[model samples]
Target: MKKIILGSLFLCASTAYADRVDNVQTEGVLSSQITMTVADITCHINQGLGISQQIHIPTISTNDLRTGNTKSVEVPLMVDCQASNDQPGSIAIHLVPAGVSTVSGDHTITTSLDSVGLELAWKDTSLPALIIGNTEFTPAQATNNVWDLSLIARPVLLAGKNVTEGNYNASLAIKVTYY
Candidate 1:
């Protein structure tokens, strides 16, 4: 019967499985511990990036002055980080440029002012500057596993363009990760 043929096939297959492993040898003792530890990473921000910031620009009348206009904005990225063994760990940050999320390798936002170019550069104020978006980089953990982060942003107009008179805006995202 068809039923008998199927049962014979199943029996043969199970017998073959045992024969396949006949030459296996027992290895040395294998052991490990699934240890658990506690770590604390905290971030504090009084205001989110959604809030529109009103920046005061003196004036934009002179062509020479407007072409060389540079503004600096200092912000705080207050954070507390603690890794295993109570030591500083490797950390990386990815800042999503204004008006982008799904795209990869995003950079600074394009200024709203017509026929004008704008660029932004940001870095940590510490001795060794950690310029965001420059290259693939990770920084050693701050002392005491805590960081009072002070970030500076420099927004400047790209050369060789006639400056325009208007207020421009941009928004960016900050993402921090540790390893």
Candidate 2:
């Protein structure tokens, strides 16, 4: 009988200990997402023109001691930065004749730009003239992205008793760069 009581007590203690034992549990959940997009770049020429009158020197004679005449030709070139990513910091433009990639003439000419207000002359004997200008996008500085540059090419007809009678044909080209 004593053994039976001891066994019963031991069993009760074991059962109590088992009940006190706790079942621990842990869990975690993680999630994430990502996305992206891209686009292509492009450029185009909006408008360009020569803002000077086409001169017609009918006849030049030897007795005429006066020098050649000068005409102001304004080459107005416009570029639309609306299509560009941002406003261009600066721009450079070069003018070349249609057939000739370089300037070759008899007389020296002076040219400049009114926007940036810069002037330069041709030092070389082969080239006719060199012109430069500065432009800004601001309304106060420059109204539009467009730059209107003026160049002066003085045509000095050779002084002699008998000069040729024919049409003197010449061409001009303008190149632009944006940064």
The per-model lDDT (C-alpha) reads 0.48, 0.39
Best by lDDT: 1
Q: Tell me the lDDT of candidate 1.
A: 0.48
Alpha-carbon deviation at 68 in model 2, angstroms: 2.2
Clashing pairs in 1: none
In candidate 2, what are the lDDT values of residues 8-67, reduced to their tens digit?
A: 999999987785556633466767776743433233453423323353333434233133
Highest TM-score among the candidates is held by which one?
A: 1
Q: How many residue pairs clash in all the candidates, one count each? A: 0, 2
- What TM-score would candidate 2 get against the native? 0.39
lDDT of 1 at 152: 55
Write model 1 residue lDDT over 39-88, tens digit each, in one string.
65443332234223444333454464464555555555544544334433
